[model samples]
Target: MNKRLQLFSEWLQEQHISLAFITSSPNVFYLSGFYCDPHERLLALLVFPDEEPALICPQMETARARQAGWTYEIIDYGDADNPWQLLERHMRAKNIKLDRIAVEKSHLSLERYEQLQACFQARSWLNAEEKLRQLRMIKEEKEIAILRQAAELADFAVEVGVNAIAEGKTELDIIAEIEYEMKKKGVREMSFATMVLAGENTANPHGVPGLTTIRKGDFVLFDLGVIVDGYCSDITRTVIFKSATEEQKLIYDTVLRAQLAAIEACKPGVEIGSVDRAARSIIEQAGYGPYFTHRVGHGLGIELHEYPSMNAANAMPLERGMTFTIEPGIYVPSVGGVRIEDDVFITDNGAGILTKYPKELIIVS
Candidate 1:
């Protein structure tokens, strides 16, 4: 059995829960070592408190699951088959009784909940999200190794974007070159949509990349990440096309200072919220408080967003092996935007910065 599965089962037994149904792709990958996008197809892992766990996925993916280190039972179904019926039979074969069952309440759909109701009469539904988050929040040595590789690839991607910039190039043009280079380097997937916001587009923060052309005084922002061996890395860097105005320089400098201060606050035993404050306070004091929106950062790993949200209201303490991003930005509607982001890992004493591309204001001319 997978060690993570064993730990979850022990927790279930202690909670007096009979079973746990994990359906989200990230959680499934974390527990079974197999990652798949079943799309509309059903993919789930049924774990019990004292009995063995079972994996349910599309029949075509069974072999791949085995190749990915799944050694136990796999209840696979074809397109024409009713997976719910198969699941019912499997539960009967194991003599499993649904008393108090645990489930990913947030990920489970209303339709699936109804289907489960037809299968058994469970007295109560327990939420398993918090336990799952706790399990995945801490990274093991091997996981950290994969994350480091992902971060390196992300750094290279930003370098590609920076070098491809020109005065008249469209935002999509640079994005195409960056992704093409990533493909040549064997990156199978991006963690999210490749964002290459130029000029006033950067002021929108989560702006859409399109035919927006780069200009002489524009701030071109490259925010993207790549996936390596099921782990993810996210980074953002903004640079000027030919030159920066004095106001643009100040915005960039303030964001950099705030981001550095936030990274410096990433020590074990410190409140996670304090990390956000470290950056927010700096930007606020610089008179750009309203322009600097959004949280300082978010947890990064198997998924782009994970546990321990880095917001001012979260009071969770930082711990070793916890990896997240420290991104601070200031966007003025009249001017442009400046954001500096880095993937950081909490160390015994300070922080381990995974993304190492130079953050100092770079002039692309």
Candidate 2:
């Protein structure tokens, strides 16, 4: 059995929980070393307090799961078969009684929860999300190695996106070029949708890439990430297609200053909120507080967004081995927007920046 799963089983025994059902893709990957998005299909890892754990997956995924280091029993179910019934049979065969069961309330759908409830009588549902979060917060050596390479690839992606910027180019065109280049380099998937917002569209924080053409003097933003060895990376960079106006330069400089300040404050024993304040204060002092919407950063590892959100109200202290992104931006409607992001890991000494793309203002033709 995997060491992480062994620890989870011990935790289950301590909580007096009969079983733990992990369904989220990241959580399942963390426990089983198997990574796959089931889409609407049923995929779950059931861990018992005393008995062995079982992976309930589609019949086609059984062999794949085993090859991915899942040595425990895997209950394979067909499309015509009811997975819940099959799960019950497996537990019954092991003489395991369902009483106090733990579930990922945040990840499990209410419809599925109802189905699970119908199958168990006199069972209590406990939240396993917090425990899972705690288990994943501290990065192991192996996980950090993967993240280091993931961040390097993210930097390479930014380079590709910036170089692809030119007059008469659409946002979609740049996105296609960047993704195509990454794919050719062996990147199988992106962490999330690749974004290439141009001109005023960059003002929108989460704007989608479209047919908006890249014009001279327009600010072009590239926000994207890729998955490497089950780990993910996120980075954002904004550049001017031609020469930047005085106003555009001010906005870009302000954002870069704020982002660097926040990353510099990333050290052990500092509260998470302080890091956000370090960036937000810079933007506010520059008279762009209202325009700087959204948090300063978010945890990044197996998933783009993980735990220890760097927000104004979160008081969690920074700890060693914690990986996250430090991103700060200033968006002014009708003017343009600028964002500078880098992946950093908390170390005993200070922040160890993984992404090393240049932060200086770059002008593209």
Specify the highest-lDDT model's number. 1
lDDT of each: 0.93, 0.90
User: For model 1, which pairs clash?
Assistant: none
The digit string of per-residue lDDT tens for model 2 on 111-163 reads 99988887775368999999889889889988888998988898998899998
Q: Compared with the true structure, what per-residue lDDT tens digits does model 1 show for residues 137-159?
A: 98888888899999999999999
Against the correct fold, how does model 1 do in TM-score?
A: 0.99
Whose TM-score is greatest here?
1
TM-score, every prediction: 0.99, 0.98
Candidate 2 yields a Cα-based lDDT of 0.90
Quote the lDDT for 115 in model 1: 89
Error of 1 at 148 (Å): 0.6
CA RMSD, predictions in order: 0.7, 1.1
